[model samples]
Target: MLTPDALGVATASTVKTLKVEAPAARSAGIKVKSVEELVEKLKNEAKVI
Candidate 1:
């Protein structure tokens, strides 16, 4: 994961132009069959809350 300090350092050293995009207004609509499956994936796959 990129922390704020790391991001700042990277931006300071970068010479190329960086384009930031705005977030989408709507959700991507990903579907899961069950809450248990979502919890398992979060714990073992994506590893994020």
Candidate 2:
């Protein structure tokens, strides 16, 4: 019989890392700053004022 502990010890596969395919969907390059800067940018640059 093979147990999880025995397999982990035998194969050293206990650790894993997750990957994100689309950084753009995750908003990778969106720069943000303080509340003042955000308000200013929203008002002036993004024209959400």
Candidate 3:
């Protein structure tokens, strides 16, 4: 997982433009702290697994 600090460093070293789009809903702010959590969310909440 790329932490904010790591992302910052990567962006600083890159020459290409990067675009970030905000979540369309407030629930998007929900944080998944690990890959297992993310997969669980995708499977249960999103039902896309």
Question: What is the lDDT of every predicted structure here?
Answer: 0.80, 0.77, 0.81
Residues 3-33, candidate 2, lDDT per residue (tens digit)? 9786776655677778757554554556677
Clashing pairs in 2: none
Candidate 3: clashing pairs of residues: none
- lDDT (10s digit) by residue, model 3, range 1-49: 8687866655355566688888677544678899999999999999999
Which candidate number has the best TM-score?
3
28 Cα displacement, candidate 3 (Å)? 4.1
Model 1 alpha-carbon drift over 4 Å, by segment: 1-29
Instruction: Please identify model 3 stretches exceeding 4 Å from their true place.
Output: 1-28
| True lDDT of residue 41, candidate 1 | 85
Q: Which 10 successive residues of model 3 have the least lDDT summed?
A: 8-17
Model 2 per-residue lDDT at 26: 53
lDDT of 1 by residue, 1-49 (tens): 9887877665455576679799879957567899999998889988997
What is candidate 2's CA lDDT for residue 14?
A: 78
